[model samples]
Target: MSDFRADTVSGKLTTFMHRARAEGVAEPVRHEAKRLILNQLKASVGATGQQAVRLMLDWAMAEAQGGGGAHVHWFGTSLPPALAAMVNGALYEVLDFHDTYIPCFMHAVSGVLPAVFAEAEAGGHSGTAVVDALAIGLEVELAVATMLMPTGYYRGMVPAGLTGGVGAAAACALLRGLDASQTQHALGLAMCTPAGIYEAAGSHTLAWITGNAARTGLQAAALASRGFTAPPTAFEGDQGMFKTHSDEDRAKIDGILASLGTEWRIFGQTYKVVPTETITHGPVECALAILPRAGGRVVERIDIKVQEIVVTIVDGRRERFGRPSSTPQATFDLCHCVAAAWLRGQFTTAETSAPCYTDAEVIALSDRIKLTADPGRPTFEGCTMTVTFADGSSESHNVDYFLGTPNARVPDSTLIDLLEQYGAGVLPAGRAHAIADAVLTLDTAPDIHGLIRLLNKD
Candidate 1:
């Protein structure tokens, strides 16, 4: 056994992650990585004109000190690799429509792909290289999340922000071709910068946290490449990351490292079919299913039973759920999402923002929705919606798996259609289709620069 096996949790993880990055991953892993990258790019394009994305891009560009190395998606400008990663990472998440890992409730693509694309573009890496780095990064991130589960969120930490830096740093290190020790240093540096609180949800600061993770990861890798040192046992000591962020007595380091590269966690990731919270997707689907039976009748009441975790995260704040003033707030409000779906028969970006948010019908229906915790329902993977019509008739639907869950992967044709639907008006004519075609065949592309070029508006 390696010395790291008996040393500490961080040591073992660092060693395992370095080894995993060095080895060749499966073709499916690479394909999934490409899909995740494409998904994030699509989301970035869709959010190109959003106020949050515009503000953050401007802030990132202003902070650039002339060391332009990489491009920001859809912005048509180059910035320092770290700054570019920050801007693009935040853009990937501005719509809240990125790929998520169900187990960790972390948006894996938003956390890792921004840094991977930035570093790959800066170094003139190939498309295959980008996929490889992303796969490795996601593996490291999911492992970290799996080990720290049930506590990270309970402690009010945002999963993406809490674990994103390490994932992004791992991808950066791989793209830079760092060895085990250097990768360890990169992870240690990343651990020092973990941030994002649950309280930041429903605010512009949420996107800022996502961007900070990408920037911090790139900076950590850059520093580590120059022989910067960090404590080896950064995750298991008394004052380590795991101890500080989680209530666990000791890190589940060995268990997390044991399955690295063997069981690909990337395969279990879920893509978002809508621009809303993952937990709300199932409930929205349930409401949509019941919409057809209502026949345009007034909804007298809506009774929703969901897992306790869902209530805690999405419906915990009565005032916010009752009346959402902002897009972010509406996205997290289950009642709002279900109500919108019931009224419109679909929940999209349009429903989460503006006139739709303040629509009288949506507000009236949302107020009638009563959310209750179901102790028997262990996971947010499913929810049941009961709609009581004014005529004293009721309809109920239960959704065990939403469209993009691992058990119910979105069909490629449907996903492509959604890409076009979401990208309409945002991307120039035919631009979205061309980008999708390139991403579908990303492995054959000579370089990622050609792909990045497609993202820029002419």
Candidate 2:
């Protein structure tokens, strides 16, 4: 039994995987992983037409020209699974549409899945194995993230990409069936590659950084599988991952991981049902439910009160919540979300596309909106809004938590609905349902790649 420090991503991952496997993952855990994987697949495929996606695919294809070891096929290409995993993972993240865990505060799945799928396909692992690996990766990433999240958000570390590196490595290690020693080393190898900045949140590079983690993780695990080794204390020792990235309280991460066996961390993984924006903005969507209570009154003033992190992340943007001109911008900008929802009377995914681009009212309303920071609240909470009408009336809505937290989790049916709607535009309708059903029952499936194959375009 190794004792790991609080800030060490590698230490937390190693501990959680051992515990997750011991407790025996529940069916709901696998189902959630399936739902997230389906979402990532759709987002990856949809990204093919984006300029960033094309650019990344071009570079990846060039990288694919020569590689060794196993053939890990990507989703949309004839390339081997490993290479495809790199591309697919990158694509999933290239758009920043993948699921995120708030506790660990990282984009865990996007980076890890490509590697898991690649290895699962290469070695012909069962869907159960893939599901287990995903759960393990997410669990580990979230646990480590929880410790690092508090201080890092203010210090400029992009928690998702930072912790995602280790998660990706863990998933790949699971796929490769690596021993514990190798697993630890693979994580160490990944810790050395963590990259991404919070400043990049609004830009196209955000998704690519996430995907890059996948590629890096897969390569690290593959190298380790072939008897490569790195520093075992990659995360823990002096001059290591935490020392370089984190600024907050040191021991919080370790204390959380210590609860790994007794507490199932997967239960903490949050899901985003509304495609509106970032994790901080999820509560804003719920707050929008109160607009009708305002009696459709014209608002003289609108004030959004959120944790300081959200204010810092979204306030400076030219149109953070207005209609986003690009895909990347829409995820973080709350102004675009509020403007669209108010103008259209609904904020569907399509609204984030071109139609919202042409709406003048959304633009005008976005200009009127003002955002204020609440220093007293937690970043995960205080995503609230207040509207004051021209008449002598006002309404205040406070979302103490986001929609996808353990207390306010998105239902399984809602997750299924989201998958169907998100995938229906690209994949056949029946195929979308099948993807959901198959994912829900993945534990009994023959191989995980079978589900990956179903995600292919006809």
Candidate 3:
């Protein structure tokens, strides 16, 4: 069963799986996985009340009450494994507050957790097993995403849709106890299913893509277990994934496959402080730094100079910058995000709502927001923000790295508090901490029963 041809992407992924399964996870790696898991669950719990999330949950609850399949966490409903992953995956991304792998601009944990947890819970996998699956799955997800990004992102491809299912498939195959060959086939099938377009981010189509990637992963793995076959050269062939999405130099990607499992890509994931796009993080930091001087002032002009790609994606919905109609739209409008935060002297999830997006004062300020992209600026981690008041006084700040990025990491305590804060609002009393505890201690624990199973005992 070990017929690894190093030139093929499937072979490379197979070797990655073999090494991980044989070696298990190191302590630090497992801890990182726990941190990623807790953060994703936090995002899922916080977004449970979103209109889109509620709509999906209402649809899933119909079949989940019977308890013969995987249970959808945060909703107390059970559905088939694939469907469970689909619903949970949508919740993970509907909020856009989850972790983003900065290199690829993808929410690294969103799609993978849904598939990993759904399969783990359905298969009665232990906490250790779940953590292993998550680490491996997220690692692969970020890897493929790295191989496609910058070029793929600029090509109008959604990074999460392109890599989420592939990561999920790798994890699901592990849970289903498939061989490396079967795992590669699952990866190939998963590779064939990435269809999300970057143009649909603020619309409902993003939720569909996120959910479909999660659903496809579980289904792909199940199909692979039944002798399903896929192209072995699906990743780096002449017309493979690499060629289809990106025009990056082939030399940079030539040795990429052999590099798997050496240094995990899971470490590249960035946690968000506010529920806005990652591109807004540094600019928001720059905005907040100068807000004390510019607060309560009538704006003559607001300018943020950032990398060109930031403008392409974060400010992609330029028309909605001053007239956002929904939460999703508000989260993507860099102009609105800074203007509203400038007016309020702070930015929080509240800014991503109707009251903030439609506020007359916020609109007046956002309408003056001018996002200038500097083509020479190539980094995603820095930006310059300038605010000019009607009095002709201007305040400016330059940020090198925002908190929550790899260089400037949000503390683990802050992330734990994020989850606990959700308990006070959305989840049941203490459910948030309970989930946090389960994730934090997962590697040494017995099982994931506390995470996905519904316990009725008083």
On lDDT, the leading prediction is 1
Which pairs of residues collide in candidate 3?
64-78
RMSD (Å) per prediction: 2.2, 3.7, 2.5
Please give, for residues 50-86, the per-residue lDDT of candidate 3 as tens digits.
Answer: 8887787777767556544676667667788888898
Worst 10 residues of 2 by lDDT: 67-76
Higher-scoring candidate on lDDT, 1 or 2: 1
Clashing pairs in 1: none
- Per-residue lDDT tens digits of candidate 1, residues 1-458? 22223265556666666676557777888888878876777666778877878898787778885669898887778998888888888898888888888887788778788888889888998777778888888888888777776688788898889789998998898889877777788888888679998788788888888988998888888898898977777776667788888875453667668888789999898888888878888888888788888887887899989988777665555544447888888877878888888888888888988788899988988888888898888678788889888899899999888888988887666666777787777678888778888887877776788888988877
Candidate 2 lDDT, tens digit per residue, 1-27?
532342445645665676676676777
Best prediction by TM-score: 1
- Using all chains and alpha carbons, the TM-scores for the candidates as numbered come to 0.95, 0.87, 0.93
Model 2 ranges off by over 4 Å: 1-23, 39-48, 66-75, 279-287, 293-296, 318-325
Q: Relative to the true structure, how large is the alpha-carbon lDDT of every model?
A: 0.81, 0.68, 0.80
Looking at candidate 3, the ten consecutive residues that score lowest on lDDT are: 449-458
Which of candidates 1 and 3 is the stronger one according to TM-score?
1
lDDT of 3: 0.80
